[model samples]
Target: MKEINREVEAILRDMIEQRVRAMISGEATSNDLLGILLETNIRESQEGGIKNAMTTEDVIDECKLFYIAGHETTTVSLTWALILLSMHPEWQERAREEVLNLFGASKPDYDGLSQLKIVTMIMHEVMRLYPPVNFTERSAAAEVKLGEVTYPPGVHFLLPHIFLHRNPETWGPNANEFNPERFAQGVAKASVHGAFLPFSGGPRVCIGQNFAMLEAKLCLARILQHFRFELSPAYAHAPYTLVTMQPQFGAQIIIRRC
Candidate 1:
C-alpha cells in the first residue's frame, strides 16, 4: 500500500510539474482540468484544517487522487475493451460501423460520443465480463438477513463482480459469452438491479464514470477510424485480477491502417 501510494504521488507530482512548465513557457495560458482540480483541492484543504490554505502540497494530494482514480481506472477499461474487441471480430465490426455512422469522415466529439449507442453497448458488455475492480467488501453494521441466509453484525460480505456477472441464471444461457447485443436496450433490460455494476452502485458509484466513458468513446472512435485491429497470431488470452483485471500475458494485436 505504501508503494502504491508513493507511485501515485510520483505520477501526480509529474503531471503538476508538466502543467507548471507549460504555463511558464507560455505553451498553455489558461487553466485546464488539472487547474480546476487544484482549485477544488485548495478549497477543501482550507475547509479541513489549513488556515490560509491552498498550498502546493494540498494541490499535489488532490492530483494524486485524480491520477489514481482517473488514470488507472480508465486505462484498465480501455485495455479490457481492446482485448474483448480483438477476440470478437463481429462485435468489433459492429462497433466500428456504429462509430462511422455516427461521425463519419469527421473528428469525434462529445456530441458524437453521445450518439454511439452500439459502441456504448459494446463497452458495457466488455466491462461486465472484465470489470476493473472485480471484488469489493462491505461490513455489516447490524444483523441482516438476505433471503434464507442470516448475517450477524460486523460480518463482512464479499461481492465478486466477475462471479456475479457470469451467473447463468441472471444472465441468459450464454452468460459467459461476449455478446454486446444483450445490452442493446441498456443495462435495465440486460440484468437485475444488483446484478450488473461495473462502476458499482448507489452513493459509492464511481465519480468519474462520465469522464471515463467519454474518454473511451473518443479513443475507440479515433482508433477504429484510422486502423483495423485483430488479435495477433501469438496473442494469449489470460485475464487475472490484481488491483484491476488485466491480461496476464499482455495485449498483443495486429493493427492495419484503414
Candidate 2:
C-alpha cells in the first residue's frame, strides 16, 4: 500500500508541477477542478500571504481523493445500475418511458433531469443494492454511547452499510429485492432513518453525493434515449469490494438501439 501510494503521489506531483508551470507561463487557462483549485490557491497566496494557501502536497491529496471518490465510485455505480436494469427489464422500461416522456429524444437538460422520478428511484435502488463503498469508518469525536456500549474519544467504528441496506427488519420483507417503488415517496421516507445510506449520512457524508447522483441520472437518461439493454448470456453475478463494490467478473450487457 505504501509503495502504491508513493507511486500515485509521484504522478500527481508531476501533474501539479506541470499545471503550475502552465499557469506561470500564461500558456493556458484551465476551467477544470484542478485549474479552479490552483486559481484559488494563487488568489489566497496573493491576498493572505503564502501560509494561507494550500501547499502542492495538499493539492495532490485533494486531487487523489476526488479522482477516486468522484471517478471510481460513480463509474462502478453506473455499471451496477446498468446490470440491475438489465436484470429487471420492467423497471428499465418504466425508467425509459419516464425519460422519454420528459425529454422526448432531446438531450436531457437540468430541469428535465429533475423531473425524472423513475430514473432517480432506479438509481437510488441500485445504490442501495450495490453501494459503491461497502463500508465507511468514523472515529468518535468524544466519548459516546450507543445502546449499552460506551466508547472513548477517537474510537473508530466501521459502519457496514451493505448489511444495513439489506436488513429485512429495516427495509421490510423484500429488502433484498429490486424495488425502486420503495423510494417513490423520496429518500427520507424510503425506510427508517439511517437505513438507506449508499453515500453514507451525516455532515461528513460523501461530498460528491449530489453531483454523482445527477451525473448518474443524466448518463442513464442518455443511454435510455439511445438504446435498449439486457444482460448477456455470459454475464455473471458476483459483486465484491476492492475499494468500491464491483462485479467480480465483468458486467456483460447486450444493448440495441432504441
Candidate 3:
C-alpha cells in the first residue's frame, strides 16, 4: 500500500511538472485554467512584492491540489450518479428523454446543458444522497465562538456533510429517499435551513464546483444519448470511505445501446 501511494505521488508530481514545463516552453495555449494560473503567477512575480509573488513550488502545489481534488470529487459523484440512475430506471429514462429532446444526435453545448432542468434535478438528488466527500475538516486560526460553543486556536472541526444532508430536521421525513423534486424550484428553495451543501458551503466550498458540474453534465449527457443501463445481477450495495465515499466492492452495471 505504501509503495502504491508513493507511485501515485510520483505520477502526480510528474504531471504537475509537465504542465509547468509546457507553460514555460510556449507549448500550452493560454486558454485553460492551468495556463491562466501559470500566467498569473508569472505576472504576480514580476509586478508584486515578495509576499504576493508565488514561487514555482507554490504553483506546483496548487496545480497538484486542483488536479487531485477536482478529479477525485467529480469521479466519485459521477460514479454515484450512474449507480443511482441505474437503480431508478424511470428517472434514468426521464433524464435520457430530456437530454434527447435538448440535444438529439448533436453534441451537448454549454447553453443547452445549462437549460437541462430535469437532469440538474437528478444530479442534485444524487449528490444529496451520496456526497463525494463524507466530511470536511477545517482548522481555526484563532479562538472563535459560535453560539454557546467556544473553540480555541488550532482546533480542528469535523463538519460531517452526510449527516446534515440526511438529517430529517433539514430535509423533512423523506430526507433519505431519492426525490429530485425537492430541487424542482431550484437549490435555493430546496433547503431553507441551510441544509443542502453538496459542495461543502460558504466561502470554503469546493472551488472547482462549476467545472465539476459541467464535466458531469457533459459526460452524463453523452452516456444518456447512446446507452441504456441498469445494475448487474452481481452488483453489491456497499459504500465505504477512504479519501472519499466510494463503492467498497464495485458498481457493476449492464449497458445496452439505445
Best by TM-score: 2
Q: Write the per-residue lDDT of candidate 3 for residues 169-231, one digit (tens) a residue.
A: 889999999988899999889977777777887788888888788899899999999999999
Q: How do the predictions measure up, each by TM-score? A: 0.81, 0.93, 0.90
Q: What is the lDDT of residue 222 in candidate 2?
A: 94
| Superposed model 2: Cα runs more than 4 Å off | 1-4, 141-143
Q: Looking at candidate 1, what is the lDDT of residue 11? A: 78
Worst 10 residues of 1 by lDDT: 21-30
lDDT of 1 by residue, 1-258 (tens): 899878877877787777656655657435667776655554566688676556666777666666667887778888888878988888888888988888887998888899899889988898899988788779999999999999999999889998889999999789999999899888898987579878888888889888888998898889888788888888788898777788888888888998
| Clash pairs for candidate 3 | none
Per-model C-alpha lDDT, please? 0.82, 0.92, 0.86
TM-score of 2: 0.93
Cα displacement (Å) at residue 230, model 2 = 1.2
Candidate 1 lands at a TM-score of: 0.81
User: In model 3, which runs have C-alpha deviations exceeding 4 angstroms?
Assistant: 1-30
Ranking by lDDT: 2, 3, 1
Better of 1 and 2 by TM-score: 2
